[model samples]
Target: MRLLLLFFTVVLGADESFITPQEYAAQLYHNPRGIGCHLCHGEHGEGKVIAHYIDKGEKKAFEGPPIRALDFRRFDAALNRRNTGMPKYFLTAPERKALYRYLHPETVKDAHAEK
Candidate 1:
């Protein structure tokens, strides 16, 4: 009986486990250049376009905006804006939270430094 209880507890505990925001951000950061966050945002999270398309009828190319990887330090302000062109990610609430946490510390550090 004790063994059965322990097994159940362990299984349930595993379900409750979650990644931290900082970890999520790191995952995003370390993601491959063309496959992960870098696919849209620039390599340094500086926001640059990775792709471009030419309109079928128009002679000029239509350039997309840089992928603005979440600037964690300015999160509050960014979230408040209505149209930032960033697509809503299909992440779970927890995953989103983790990503936010991970990006924020780095962004904060960047924002404060002399550039």
Candidate 2:
């Protein structure tokens, strides 16, 4: 009886370190490489106005566009390409997919299910 209890406890303890896909995606979204997407994009990727400035006294708002609504193709493409102010992280395919999943939870499916 004691051995059975010990075995179950060990199994449960091992399971604690294994994070779900959503949790992994959240980590990638928040801190991929050294820069966090949330710095410019909003906490949930809803976009944000990073700064306000006077460009030749014109008054300009430097903003991060909402990314939560972008489809996977567009999202992947944007990350791969160079934008005017956006940093080039050159993330891998899996990293990009994870980020997309984090933004669009509704579309998330079991990764293994696709195979």
Candidate 3:
């Protein structure tokens, strides 16, 4: 059994494309470019509190917008344009689509599926 597996491995030549579409999407979501979407958006893109502090003798909070419910058009526009708070990312069309799909898994079941 070991010899057979080794033979297949050698024939396939050290394949690293074993990650599933969901796994790849997760990786891209977590480490696309330099920052992870989860840093601001919640793990499931449900939004999150980025920071809390005091200003003008009062308390304030900086929050990341929830994006799980966004439509593809809005999502694409948000990523492509120069937003006020968001860091501009030069992701490809497919990449942006992938991220959007990642943000909304239910509606996009197999829509952007790629290995």
Candidate 4:
């Protein structure tokens, strides 16, 4: 079992090292664990209305707020902390960073430079 786990880790790590930061981030944004962030957030994290319904004779929209404009701190906090209407992702620091990079491509260069 340990050998199998190590083999898989090495194989995955090899693939991970070859992909561009954007590509890695894109994958994570599209599907982290079993859920796709884009399903709630927009294609580019611009936010979207998930569903529309009537409450007490008033129409309301269930929406995922725009995450693209958020700073890394706030973005990370939101993903890590449990909140109403959002699932508990329990993502690691690196995963959260990747998701944030997907929303803000401009930071990609800075991220690379840091490494």
**Most accurate candidate by TM-score:** 4
**Cα RMSD to the true fold for all candidates:** 8.3, 4.5, 3.9, 4.8
Count the clashes in each prediction.
3, 0, 0, 0
Q: Give the Cα error of residue 51 in candidate 2, in Å.
A: 0.7
Write one digit per residue (lDDT tens) for candidate 4, span 25-49.
8998888985798988889998989
lDDT tens per residue, model 2, 1-115: 9999999999998776566778888998888986799999999999999999999879999999999988789999999898888888978899898888888888766743431
Q: In model 1, what are the clashing residue pairs, if there are any?
A: 21-98, 21-102, 22-102
Candidate 3 per-residue C-alpha lDDT over 4-114 given as tens digits, one digit per residue, 9 for 90 to 100? 999999767745465556667788999989678899888999999999999999999888899999889998898889876678888998888778878777755563354
Question: What TM-scores do the predictions have?
Answer: 0.39, 0.79, 0.78, 0.80
Range of the 10 consecutive residues with the lowest summed lDDT in candidate 3: 106-115
Give per-residue CA lDDT, model 1, range 1-115, as digits (tens). Answer: 9999999999888754554444446675555222465445555455665445567765553233442454544543443354444544445445444445554464444432321
For residue 64, model 4's alpha carbon misses the true position, in angstroms, by 0.4
Off by over 4 Å in 1: 1-21, 28-35, 56-88, 106-115
Using lDDT as the measure, which candidate wins?
2
Question: What are the lDDT scores of the predictions, listed in order?
Answer: 0.50, 0.86, 0.81, 0.85
Where is the poorest 10-residue window by lDDT in model 1? 106-115
* Stronger candidate by TM-score (3 vs 4): 4
